[model samples]
Target chain A: MNDSVIHIEGLHKSYETSAGLFPVLKEVSLHITRGEFVAVMGPSGSGKSTFMNILGCLDHPSAGSYRLDGHDVATLDKDALALLRNRTIGFVFQGFNLLPRMSLQDNVALPLIYCGVERAERHQRARELLVKVGLEKYFDSMPNKISGGQQQRVAIARALINRPSLILADEPTGNLDSHTSTEIMALFESLNREGITIVLVTHELDVAQHAQRQVHFLDGRIVNDHATLHTEASL
Target chain B: MKLAMLGEAWRAMGANRMRTFLTMLGMVIGVGAVVLMMSVGQGAQYSIKQTISAMGSNLFVLLSGSSSTGGVRSGSGGSYTLNVADAEAIAELPGVQAIAPIHPGSAQIVYGPNNWNTSIIGTTPGYLDARSWPVASGNTFTDSDVRSATRVALIGKTAAQNLFGDADPVGQTIRIRQSPFVILGLLSTKGQGMDGRDQDDTIIIPLTTAQRQVFGSQFPGSVRMVMVQTTTQEIMPSVEKSMTELLRQRHRIREGLDDDFSLRNLTAVADSAAEATRVMSLLLGAIASVSLLVGGIGIMNIMLVSVTERTREIGIRMAIGARQRDILLQFLLEAIIISVIGCFIGLLLGIGGALLVELLTGTKVIIALSSVIVAFGVAATVGIFFGYYPARKAAQLDPIEALRYQ
Candidate 1:
């Protein structure tokens, strides 16, 4: 049996707004295998973001069973969910979300620090990841000192520091120009070829096209899922 | 895990150097002030008590009035006359070690070309022993002087200093209010009292001479007041009761009439003063403690701002695999560190400030180690107590939403 990284059945998430019980995710069921590069696309309020949150273990399903790495999400308490998130998932944000006060190396080492890695070992792992992201020369540079594209590269390096099973990127290139967006997407594709599973959430078609599988979402449910032809060799 | 979290917290705090320092300043001042104030207050009280106790055991003053707490008071008539015979009568009572009737008056002392102002106290031979007055030179007034109403007098150090100037005052003859009197003795110096009055600015003469020759009053054989000493502190009440009964019988008070002469216990008075001072110091400490609370609130305010400002950083950490407790603990630890450091600085500054006050003012300041401990403990408690809410807020944040924060 191919090991499934995440399995969600009939996931329902409803938010209490002034309009009352507005459903963000309605009867959403999906399964993602380990080592798959999947992209989710949708307009605003399409529940794609909600799905990403659930997949990253940052939130629990409202009324559904979410089993991540074969462990049930509902069984986890607040702290246990946090531990699962820390141990199994890594995240990158659209705005890069690099802490401006921290050096590139520190930013990359942050996840490993949360994972309770020793100082020297955490530093070594962060350095290796930074080198992989072509940020070896900029290890000591602060987030603000680097270009938008380079900051995103640092963020990606941070996401890989814990060697997480799944890498979650939400609007990873939302703030970057087209050229930088292509570069960051290419970095994601290269990371995918190394056998790390990726679940990317974005509204942009060009950014979504870089993944092997693309799922479109509308009104809190998946509308269509299509296979995309892209690999590290093509990039 | 603990060390790593601590390191992360330190790094985060060090990142905002100015904010951390400013936040710590409040705790520093508060703790310092509390420690310093308590020490100084305790010192003042201790010194005062020491001065009182040095006056001797169970020394009391009996004055004629409705109420007189101390020797100095206003708006009262001297109704009871404590005469030499009354003094002798009190001396005969059990537990009464010594009794001296004092006749206080002012006079001018003239020796050679030097003349000086001085208070003249006329009493029996036991007067010196009662008041803890030690003779420095010449002999004190003998019982013969009391009977003969002799013109010989014992001069205090201040009187000797003023009238005789470096010359030996024992053999000198000084004119007291133009009446020539031989200085038979020179008394040793006793420092200033709690009332800031000089204890060594007087001349002692025989009680009979002061009553007959100086004042020229005869009826009832009136005297100023009597100083009484008990054999021991435990027998004071019985001594007081017998003396009161004797005086009352002499005065012929009706069945329920209050005694005309009022008795004052020096030990009780000293104890009361100490209690008052203790209460005053406590009040001062309480007022100063408000600053510590304010400091805690200040820490909370800054922590709130810090949590909000670091929302994205919190998200990033959470995404990286940080437990909610880790994030919470990080912020909480930072707040605690700030408070603890503030307390330490406050303690140092407090002690320094107290010393400075003492140096400048010549006031006794006691630095109690307990105060230092209290300051530090208060600071630490403030940190933990006030830092909880913000830490919880930071911990409960959604990673996805926090990451989306621009």
Candidate 2:
């Protein structure tokens, strides 16, 4: 637990619907140490999304403990949780959530704005990341002007802007073609090789092969957790 | 951080220019109406104050009682009940500052080849003191001028202009009813009176000269009216009561009989006129404030719609670690930018409208700096006040639910 990036125990999450209390995650426990790239995989309504939300500190579990980067998220208030997420975890959503009105550089620098970074430093850091993502020439272009793969690359650059300990990608390549998905996975693999921990949620078996380990969920429970056996073959 | 948020707010507004402009139109019209109405009302009040000051302060006009011949009564100044002695007697009373015996009429004056008809006032030198008038170019007629019935006269600006054209009238001789009178001084311009009459289109001469030498009064030393002034406004009531009692006693009238003269507190009349103008300005401001309120409501409505429309954007910001306060600040800043920019535009439009009104109607309009500051302050306050609810609603949104919203 000393070197763990994500530590959870008996985590339970439920939604109060109009009819009754609907349980999504029940009695779940997971531990992911630093520098580990893990994939969360499940069919629809298998609670993988809820588990990823808890790991990202975006939502609190109904009952149990969740410690992300050494902070007990359940004990934190809403603002504190937001701060924790800003400083410790980065999120890449299925929909490339780049603000439509902002330029690509501004979209990448948005997270720094919440943490009170100065404009010149934010611009410099965003430029570095956009260059790292190979979209440095399109810094001033709007998100709509970029292709799906390029927008996703920009989203990845935005996720890495704050240098967070953990990258939480929910279907990071969900909207991409197979070739584009392979490129995104290669980017994630290169990032993970640089010692940043990544926790991605995807149902595709080939996408999950990129991660060092894969955790599978079924009926609100983890049914399988194992190291990938076909990483070399898939690559 | 706030400055960055303001930039974000500005871009957000720039995203939908048409919607933003329509929303800002309400504030524009509202602030425009307020500024314009305030300017017009202040102009009216300022003109009234000028008129009041021109007429004089703490003044009273005592008109001689009307004469009745078999129930056909004349006006208050139609009889010779008031005279120069009565004015001198009133001067000795306590709280009395100055007194002027006046006999006024209209007559044709001739200077060289120019002949013009103008008002002629026969008054003592105290009239200038009571009216707070100053000589513009030459000396005023002295008390000795009145006592010896001199033909020295003071020419008003309008009368001087009409009689002498561009030439100096100080030493020129003007004939009143064919009797030559030397112009002693040029009285300063008083512009227009409250009754819309040109106060500078008149002349002033010695009371004795007007009564004896010019008009030839039947009763010696009797004048048409007496103008009295008190030392302070607070002493006017007591002075009026004492003067009434003194006049009644001096005239030897019985207790139940009416006095032989009528006294009017000109200051009170002027004060009421000023008060009426004050009320009128306040009413105009209140009416304009209603439009401001409607504009504020319009801002609130648009902000609410904006919040609703931008729910998904809010969710996206929250997902990336934006706190509730950040969201709130962003939206509030948007609202404030819209209103403040609208207020600035409205200020320009209002000043332009006021100047246009002045140019069209030839009315005086004053756009005081304090009024501009107040309009700006109120507009900013209205923006914050109306933008609060929508901003708070955006702040309190559930991130998970907002993220899922289409």
Per-residue lDDT of candidate 2, residues B290-315 (tens digit):
88888888989998999988899999
True contacts kept of each: 0.82, 0.72
DockQ, 0 to 1 scale, candidate 2: 0.75
User: Which tens-of-lDDT digit does each residue in B271-311 have in candidate 1?
Assistant: 77888889988988998899989988999999999998889
Q: How close is candidate 1 to the true structure, as a TM-score?
A: 0.83
Provide the lDDT at A233 for model 2. Answer: 73
lDDT of each: 0.83, 0.92
Docking class of 2: medium
- Candidate 2 per-residue lDDT, tens place, A140-217, comes to 999999999999999999999999999999999899999999999999999999999999999998899899999999
Each model's TM-score?
Answer: 0.83, 0.95
Q: What is the TM-score of chain A alone in each candidate?
A: 0.94, 0.97
lDDT by residue (tens digit), candidate 1, A3-73 = 89878899999888998888899999888898888899999988888888888877777898988887888
Off by over 4 Å in 2: A232-235, B112-114
Cα error, residue B111 of model 1, in Å, equals: 4.5
lDDT of 1 at B202: 86
Backbone clashes counted, model 1: 2
